[model samples]
Target: MKAAIFKGPGAVEVGERPEPVIQEPTDAVVRVVLGCVCGSDLWYFRGESPHAAGSIGHEFIGIVEQAGANVRSVRLGDLVVAPFIYSDMTCPHCRNGSTISCPAGGSFGNGTIDGGQGQAVRVPQAGGTLVRVPGSGHSDEVLRSLLALSDVMSTGQHAAVMAGVKEGDTVAVVGDGAVGLCAVLAARRLGAERVIALSRNPARQKVASEFGATDIIEARGDEAVQAVLELTGGTGADAALECVGTGQSIATAAAIARPGSVIGIVGVPHGEVPFTGTFFRNIGWRGGPAPARVYIPGLLDDVLDGTINPGLVFDYETDLDHIADAYRAMDERRAIKSLVRVGGI
Candidate 1:
């Protein structure tokens, strides 16, 4: 078998690796059908992530080739989506709908767990972590949307939920990456009356509109903050989703939110936030590792029913052998997200 391996910063290669087998009673060996590079993957590739060399992917969808004796929710031949984090559903946090932070859960691609960017992956807690896809024959578009259910889509939904978006509320989203674009869709699906997106990228602006952004703000710095405020009358948005983790983006989210509104930040923050400014304005902030495991089931239904189409975020596609190219494209900002076909249905 072949897997994407990270040798060092700015380095990823498709190298021969051991095939996965069911190692636990609750595990399932999945024949990966589709996998993609995540923004987080860039962190490791750029040497910014703390984890050392290991398998390089987490977002994926696949067909179950085999399952351990205790696996009950899924079986052979089932097509499923695996969350980036694997969790035993019975844990207290999982039961409370915070599976991503499950006390026993851990990431799948850190060399401790077989990563999803391979021909096959052994998924622990299969019964709780895998969401089965409904049909036999799914188009590329459908598969792409289903893939989003694994992480980005659910994370975006979490951002909106945490931000307190409500029916008739005006919402603003900071950043135009895949998560931000998906946040636009999530806000729309959640019933925000007006969706305002802050982006200067033409490609992202187009996708944001398709996802239901009623307004696009192309300004930066104070101009961008003023633009969002102007769009929502004299007040800032009722809620704001911060999809970028930079200090500047965090401030932008806080600056563009109404006095009593909340800012949901989903980006992996790299530095300290300016809490003093946020405290003075009375703007609440919430969000961390998105409990994508908790939202997958409900969002899967929406994907199957055509309520949303987030696969549109995958603007580039390639084979697993070309995984390096995919990373380069995303690193260069030439692609919103890249999909890699690891195997077949």
Candidate 2:
């Protein structure tokens, strides 16, 4: 088997590794069909993530190659989406829709489990973590979209949902990366009347519009704030999604929303959140590493039904042998998202 590993800053390598097998009764082996790099992976690729140099991907969809005796929710030959983290669905936290906080949950490539960007990998808590899509086979396009359900789309939806986006509420998405663009789509799907996307890149702005962004702000800082405020008729957006995970983006979310609005942080925050006026303004802050397992089931239906095309975010695809280029494509911003085909599932 071959899997991606973090070598150092600006480096990733695809190399051979031992094949994974059912190591526990709760485990299942997944034959990864499609996998994509994530923005969070940038933290590692750029030497920004503290813990690097491990198996390096977490978002993917695959076919069930084998299931442990205790796993019952899926069986051999089932197509499934594996969220970024593995959690026992039976846990109280998962039952209440917080699988990310499940006591026994853990992320892939975190030293305990191999990451998903490989030919095959072992999945823990298979019954609770893997969402079995209804079908036998699907198109490459559909598979790519279903792959988004594992993380990118689900994370974007979580940001909107946490921000309390309502039928008439305005949404300001503070980033133009794949997650942020998907946030625009998610906000609209949830019925937001307006979606303001903060992006200076012409390409991203275009995709943001296609995804449902009603407005685009090309400025940054207070200038961006004023733009969002003016666009919303001076009241500001009802909710803002900070999808870049930078202090500046978070600040924009804090400054661009109306008082008493919610600001969701879906980006993996890199620095301290400036809790200054944000605390005094009664502006609620919500969302963190999304509980992707909880959101995938419903998002799966949308993808399967063709109601959304979040996969548009993926602009590059390659086989596992070219995985290094996949990382470079994302790091250089050559592609909004890069997909790695593991096998012909």
Candidate 3:
């Protein structure tokens, strides 16, 4: 089989690799149907978080080729979606609906297990980690949309949920990346009356509008704060969803939020949250790596039922052999997200 190997920063190649096999009774060997490069994957691509040569990918939707004896929830030929993080659903955190907090869980493409950017992957905790992709067969668009349930959509939804978006509330989303756009959609879906998106690109601003952003702020810092305050009648947003992890973005979120509001840091934080400023303003903080495992099921239903079409975020599509190009497209901001057909499905 051929798989993507992260040899070093800025170097990902498709090369021959060993086929996956069931390594545990809770495992399932899945023949990947679709996989995609994540924004977080850029951390490895840029050498920010270095990794020795190994298979690398995390978001995937596939068909179960085989399952071990202990895997009871999924079976042969079942189309499944594997969240970015894998977990045993029976663990205390999982049972309580916090799968990412599961003590028995780990990442999908941390290199010990087969990564999703390949022909097949060995899924640990298969019964708990795999969510059946709904239909026996699905159209390409439907499948693409369902793929978002694995991570992007789940994380966006997590940001909104953690920020405490409520009906009639004004919500501001920081960042214009795919996750931020998805956060806008998630906020609207959760009933926020007005979603203010901080976007600089016209294209992304259009997408944000489609996803329910009633207003778009194109400035940063104090100008951006004034924009939000002006939009909300000088009160500021009821909650702010911080989708970018930079120190500046974090401060922007805090600045645009109303007093007594929560700022959800959905983006993987790259710097320390400014404490003195946030503390003095009485702005609450929450959100981290999303518990995608717990959020996938309901989001899957929304995808299948046509309530949301997050696949629109995937602006470029390619095959496994062109995985490097997919990575480059995302790295260069040429694509909001790239979707790859793993086994030509």
Candidate 4:
């Protein structure tokens, strides 16, 4: 077997590794068909995320090669999508629709959770964590879109939901990365009348439009704030989403949110949130680790029915042998998202 191992910061190598096997009654082994690089994965690659030499990847779609004795929702030959985090699905947190924070769920890789960026990987709590793809043969578009359900798409959807976006509401999204772009689409799917995206990248701006954004602000800080306000007729957006995990992005989200409006932040914040004036303005904040596992089922139906094509975010694709290039393309912003085809399902 072959997997991409993180050697250190700014480094990754494709090397031979032992294949995974079912280790728990609730576990299942998957033969990875397609995987993609995530924005969060960059943190580990840049030495910003806490990790060591280990399998790297979380968002993936694959075929079930084997299932544990207790697994029932999925079986051999079923194509499924695995969320970045694994949960037992019966825990209180999972039952309440917060599977990502499931008291029993843990992250993949890092020697605790099995990482998915490889030829094959083991998934725990398979019955609850893996969503079976509905059909047998899927086009590239369907496959890629289904793969997005594993993480970025669901994360984006969670961001919008947290922000309280409603029908006819004006929604502004900060950041135009894969997650951010997906947020733009999610806002539309959720019935937002006007979607405002803050991004200077022309490539991303184009995609934002396709995803239903009515406006694109190519500025940041005060200038960006004014742009969003101008679009909202002197008022800020009714809801705003912060998809970038940085101090500046958070500030911008807060600045562009209408007084008493909500700002849903999904970015893994590494810095302190500036709460100055937030309380006095009556602004509300809601967001945390996106429970992607909870949203996969409904989102999958949309993908299968052609209601949405979030896979448009993937502008680059390659096989596992060129996995390092996939990381560099994303790191350099040359690609909105990169998909790696490890094998066929």
Q: Residue by residue across 1-345, what tens digits does model 3's lDDT show?
A: 989888889999998889898889999999999999999999889988876578989999999999999999998999999999999999889998788888878887777877889899999899999998756657788898888878888889999999999999999999888899999999998999999999889888988998889998899888998899999999888989999899889888988889889898888888778878878889989998888888888888888888888887898989999999999999999989999998744
For each candidate in turn, the TM-score is: 0.98, 0.97, 0.97, 0.98
Candidate 2 lDDT over residue span 1-345, tens digit each = 889877788878888778899989999999999988988887778887665576768998899998999999999999999999899978788899999888878888765578888888899889888889897667777888899988889899999999999898889999999999989989999999889999999989998999989889999999999999899889888999999887888888888988898898898786578777877888888998888888888888888888888998998999888888998898999999999988877
lDDT of 4 by residue, 84-171 (tens): 8889999888999988777767887665544667899889889898999988889989999998988899999999999988899999
**Worst 10-residue lDDT window, candidate 1:** 47-56
Model 1 vs. true fold: TM? 0.98
Provide the global lDDT of candidate 3 against the true structure. 0.89
The regions of model 4 sitting more than 4 angstroms off are none
Clashes of 3: 0
RMSD of 3: 1.2
Report residue 209 deviation for candidate 3 (angstroms).
1.5
Q: Estimate the overall C-alpha local distance difference test score of candidate 2.
A: 0.88
> Would you list the clashing residue pairs of candidate 4?
109-113
Error of 2 at 325 (Å): 0.6
Q: How many collisions between residues are there in candidate 1?
A: 0
